[model samples]
Target: MNRKLWAALFLAGLAAPFLIYPVFVMQLLCFALFACAFNLLIGYTGLLSFGHAAFFGGAAYVTGYLVKNAGLTPELGVIVGTLAAGLMGYIFGILTIRRQGIYFAMITLALAQVIYFIALKAPFTGGEDGLQDVPRGMFLGLVDLGHTYHVAGKPLELNLYYFVFIIFCIGFWIIHRAIHSPFGQILKAIRENEPRAISLGYKVERLKLLAFVISASLAGTAGATKSLVFQLASLTDVSWHTSGEVVLMTLLGGLGTVLGPVVGAFTVVALQAELSAFGSWVTVVIGVTFVVCVLSFRRGFVGEVLEKIRTRPPGQND
Candidate 1:
């Protein structure tokens, strides 16, 4: 059943760009991957991080700088960005892994704020203007990512779109593999009962730190790809509000469920895009939608559907 669903999703993704604006679809893919990375921590490891934008936005700046100023290839830029985010995560994990609950969340948020300020003041980042005009660069020294092709009578950046798609798939696959591995089970055990996990001789701190780094790196991958997609990296990418947005995406999609984040990301992105004409009023609509979802579907959209399936009467095909 899961395989079928994954196959269907892959088909849909392949066809989506032809039907929708390629850039908008690419943006959605990036955010979906971002939300999925966040879920790995909060949903699987039971760690609530309130500053994921540090990894997401920080990696964007790194990738943007490298691809634009240093003239690194797109692939290399993303790799370096991912590694940088992982290193940051390792340092952050060392400092905050000992704390739990709100303390942990607050510590993460504070650290993220520091990154935000640094980006704001750093001359290379263009300050409030952001790192703009970030060239997409060559892909493997073969295809020009900046070049566009006419597809089905529409201008489509097929090269860049495919590049982003490949990155998204790789990142998504890593998260899926992590969630299903023995390490992931231990994470689940830790999430269920940390005391019991420790009693079982599990090095809980090490495991949590590992999880944090993995999540941060994947989030960084999403951000790096996003920078290439939009050709810009700004304060908005690293802001606290972006962090909150990911939280909402994870919750609205069904927290621990594997497909929840993607679904939630789609809904939120679609709403924002469609409601853009409303200007600042868009936030009000999103807030109202979130409240309605919370009230009507406590388990989240996908979570509620899964619950129904689980509780259905045996042999009832209908």
Candidate 2:
């Protein structure tokens, strides 16, 4: 939340491509943004959505289809994809916003299943194989996203990585602004005590609905950017597994904290990449990690750290 931390993160991101694979970093950024979007609804708004993958994967499919088949530019395709996801979120929120707690979560899960079935049958989705070979296309009819750049005497394919990073930063800034705005306060009020917010004359349902739509739109933006990075949109993106993954990222990072999702996303993504060779064992390891984190660090990695810092004795130095 401080300028110093922001500067440090920016510098780390700038130097990451040189230290690690660009594509991997791009994936981390995408998932980080997605988790932040999810956190907006569940962490701040107290809305537990179980079907977030619908927006994320749906947007990926849409952007991939538009870029590959509809001949749309990369940026335009991503924008349309994000908007489509927001529209879907609006409809879903209308249907489920009245429900509370587990019921709301279940309804969202059901809706996501419906969307999943639609994707399975839709011709554009290519059934199980999903939309493949999605072209990254040129950025704004200029800057070829598929191009590579040389840095430090080594060739780094950073064009797409930088593009995704810029998009992530924009999305992060928007989310940060929203979280600190008056509207965000109302959402938090609704989250803390909906009846009180309603008693105070807040349109609780409307606020929740708006928060839901914004969260979905941002998630969709992440998915769309991911599709460009990988040149593919698959069922894996929309599967229930992905929905769970996003939840895990948010929980691991610390819900309600701005940078929690980023930390969680990086950790989960890095673990998966590192354990790729282990195949099914990777899931076991992640499961164990999740259980440990939940039991030992309930506030999440970043959340717990921040809490310690805030609750530390005055004049005590780390």
- Can you tell me which runs of candidate 2 are displaced by over 4 Å? 152-154, 315-318
User: Model 1, range 1-318, lDDT digits (tens) per residue?
Assistant: 888988998888888889889999999999999999999999999999999999999999999999999999999999999999999899989999999999999999999999999999987899999999999999888889999899768999988988998898999999999999999999999999999999999999999999999999999999999999999999999999999999999999998888899989999999999999999998999999999999999888899999998988798676
TM-score of 2: 0.97
RMSD of each: 1.9, 2.0
Local error of candidate 1 at residue 76 (angstroms): 0.7
| Candidate 2 C-alpha lDDT tens digits along 98-173 | 9999999899999998888888998779999999899888989898988888887877777777888899999999
- Residue 190, candidate 1: alpha-carbon lDDT: 98
TM-score of each: 0.97, 0.97
Q: lDDT of candidate 1?
A: 0.94
